[model samples]
Target: MSSGDGRAPGPLLLLLLLLALPRSAGRRRAVVNRSIPDVCATCHIHATCQQSGGKSVCICNYGFVGNGRTHCQDKDECQIGASKICGNHTLCHNTHGSFYCVCLDGYRASNNNKTFIPNDGTNCTDIDECEESGLCGHNARCVNTEGSYMCYCNDGYKLETGEHSFHQDENNVSCKEIGCGSPPEMKNGYIVGNYSVQPGSAVHYECREGFYSNEGKFSYCTENGTWEPATLSCKEIDCGKPWLIPHTTMTWDNSTTLWSRVYYHCKEGYYFNGDKNFSECTMDQSWENITYVCEEEELFSNLSIFNETCVRWQKKTGRLGVQEMYTFHVQGQRWYQKNFFHEMTFELFTHKQAPEVCLDLQPGTNYSINISMVALNFSLLVSMTTQITDPPFPEVEFVAVKGSAPLLRLRKAEDQNGPISLYQVIVLPLDLQSTFICDSFAATTFFSNTTDIKGYVAAEFQAKDVADNMSIALGDRHYYGKFYNAPLKLGQEYCVFLKIISEWNKVRTQSCVIWAQIKNLSPSLQYMTAVGLGSVAAVCLVLFLSFSVARSCLHRSVHPPPAAVACEAVHLSTTVDVASAGIASLFLETESVSLL
Candidate 1:
């Protein structure tokens, strides 16, 4: 049967039967009954539940639930428990078996949650909303709100972009803008606005018009970014063309500017401005700084006569010669002494007439006279003077020897005059001594061949005068003799004489005597013959020894020896054949046959 609730009666009956068993069995039945609910509810409950095998069984409080499986899920407590779990200033959030707290409205969760837990007070945290974009104005500060922020600019500042606040951090920052003034202006040759006028920028330099900038162009900035250091100069300063001065010629080209050359010359009578010959123009537009003068030409006379002074003769000191004369003029007049006088004899006349008289006085007959003139009117008188003359005939002295080549020499006594002429030399042999005026000088050289004449040989020299008068004789007699070929006897005496011839046929002679003795020579024939014999004997002995030694060497070389066993085995040999059989036999026989 079944229970009234439509439950199966079998389960109920089984329950009763289990209970009717013994006490221990029945207690065991009750325990099994209790385990059945846990197992059954595990799959059907939420939250708090017991798990049976793979199923969960529990029931959770509000905002918490669980599936019939193992896991539990939370409900949005902030939405569902808004009024109860969280206060007005907080929010609540649900999680598995719990709820989170969060601030609401102007308040925020202290723990940073969006929901609040039941009975958990909410903490309202300050919100730094100023960190968000657009929270601060440009050049302004930002303030945080409960849930928002506000922007405000600083005093005396404005935003770059017109807005309550700039959205970006970089956009909100602002700085003052810098502006450039006007650029400097240039005048004259230069144009304005040529350079940039920005602050701290520089303006370049340039020249103006005909005036070149001495330095760089002066530059200054105006209030409106315009600058003009100073007006560029345009004043006219001309370098004029150079000009030539009077009586001067310029050498420089017209195109030259700084330097130019000008040459100046003097007129016929006037001098140059500087040097008499030339002048130059200077850069200061002035002529040569110096001057010169010219003088007149000097005059010279063609002919004039000055006074004559007395002059001593160059060749003769106090006297003069007849052939020498001195003639001079004074104011065109000739003065001289006429007759070889010792004092001045004056005569006045013109140059032509004076020269005529001088010619007359200078004739050949007056060669010994010397004349000279003194101051204008003074005349030097002179006479014929003569110097000492050398004697015409030269002295003759000489010596001669018989049978010898005799020489005769003539010399002047004073050596003042030159050589004498018209002189003759003579000789007389021993046979003609009496008549020996033989037209030759004494002892004049002669040759003889006869060997037996014994007598004095007389020789004489005579000098003839220009009048053809013969001078005294100069003679030299030499005693000589020719003897037989035998040696001359010792202690003999001899005489020799010499004579010289002079002009005018004058002759002078001299003589000398000397004794001569003969000297004997020693005889040496026997000593020479002995030396010859010794030399011959030495030669003959040398020849005999050489012949014997050569014969022995020939004999030894001609003989040969018999061959020996030991000698035949060796290759060495001598120029003389010692290995021959004949030589060996001879050597052995000689050795064995020595003299006993």
Candidate 2:
């Protein structure tokens, strides 16, 4: 008013000045809204007043709203118009005074999953959870859709806890191995060792005797029902190279592929102990589990002492008893012979040390005898022939002149009922006497037993052709060798006795077999001489013919025939010469054949 000059009325000017000054908030609260304000001063700075209910009231401005005094809520301009104020794919959320635009669950702001303002030029972009690291653990697959994620186990693996989706933080979901299916089928053999068939589990296989493994030796279970290159197979077992026995040479039918016996022998000057000398290559691809040892003769003081622990292997030399003539011994030998007990009669041709009783005995440096007999009782008679040779020690054993020795044999026990016979015709009658001979020997004894036996010796036993699934024993029970007598001094003779006892085992079976027949195998000198002379005569004839042919060829080459000479006059004489040369080559080959 003062500026307008003229000095307006003082009271009026004072009233106008009071209205110009701003009123305190506390004072304004006390004053009720009874009149309309000339300006927007009664309301918040951003608000205005309006008439309502016949009274002036504070109201929010067009872009702001609230109680109108303390605060002013901003209008969501982004949500107002039909045209999206926040733009496409942008979320509008009202804030304290304004609103913000952001992407939806699957959409991001400005190509990123972040909050942004609309009209600030930000656009929503899809979130790809799959692209993020740590979304899935090992052996898992991840897929993203919208704002969600999913996970799956890789091949050979399954989700843990039957879960179908991936987990974060808690990480409750995981991939676990879904082991391979049942292990490969085994043929000709069976699996052993490991009991599990899960992935990474291993199993071993073994082939039966006389067979080998043609495919996998050992196999393992793998992921996804797959095997890691290992397969199951078996053909026949192969016992590679003989069992490792030092200082011994192996003797086996090398022609055989498997399960053949491998006999061992100590080198000269070395003697066999009770150690193993023979082991069979079993179908399980393993040699008989027997240990062997050899000692030197120097360790033994008196060689004859070994006679007590005698071991022998004998071969046939001849069949003398069949041809020789001798008196009936049934009358004289009845006292000591088994014929007295069994009522069996057989022949014998022998020389003994008794100067009186050996009346018909031929005088000899050493005891020599020949014998051949047959048991009239059995259906088929299995014969076993034996011959002995001088060993590195004194071998003949002599007892007091008495019949106290046993005359028992397994053939008597073979009559037992209900037991299977080891050999259909293997029989040896015992004829032991006080003055009989004893020597070392080795022998193979085959016996089959029921389930009661504690030490099972054989299974699926096979010697030459015999085989079975039942338990059995082969060879000597203690020595593990073929039974035989040793060191009869070649030309010398021996008093042989056959005896076996069938004790507790009523189901036992055994037999005796000959290795080979006796024969005089010496070649005739006359035949050898004749063959040599014939060969020499043929060689001489060939040499003479060769010389004659060479001379004829020389004559032809030096003096050409008239027909060949005529060819020289023609223009094709060189070709004619070549043809003649070919003919000469033919002649040479022909001569060579004739010579052969």
The clash numbers for all candidates, in the given order, read 82, 26
After superposition, which runs of candidate 2 have C-alpha atoms over 4 Å from their true positions?
1-41, 49-59, 62-94, 104-107, 111-113, 117-123, 129-142, 148-204, 207-596
Query: For residues 1-596, could you state the per-residue lDDT of candidate 1 as single tens digits?
Result: 66689866687689877877777887998899887655444543444555556765465545555553565566665565555656555555566556666665555666566654545544666677666665563456777666655565664444545444543344535522222355444554454446554444556555443444344554654433345466455332222333223333445444322233433443454333334543343333223333332222211112222221222223222222323333442211111121222223343322221222321232111121222322221122222212222333344443433322323344433222222322323222333344433233333333233333233333333322222223222221232221111111112222322323323224332222121111232223653465566556555655665565556556765544445323432322331233343333432212110010
TM-score of each: 0.19, 0.25
Name the TM-score of candidate 2: 0.25
Worst 10 residues of 2 by lDDT: 376-385
> Which candidate leads the pack in lDDT?
2
lDDT of 2 at 124: 68
C-alpha lDDT of all candidate models, in order:
0.38, 0.43
lDDT of 2 by residue, 1-596 (tens): 35457766688778876776656654786575645454446688767778888766788776686877666777766667422767765567776556667666656667453666654566766678778776788788778766566787877677657665555535666788786656666666666666575777777777654566545577777665465655655565445555434456777787335657878787766667655678876554445555455444221122111231121211123432333322222111111111211112344333321111122321111111211222211011111111111211211122221212212112222222112222221111122223222221113334332222111111121122233222222111232222211111112112333222111122232332221121222223653565566556555655665565556557779877767646544524444455545543432212100000
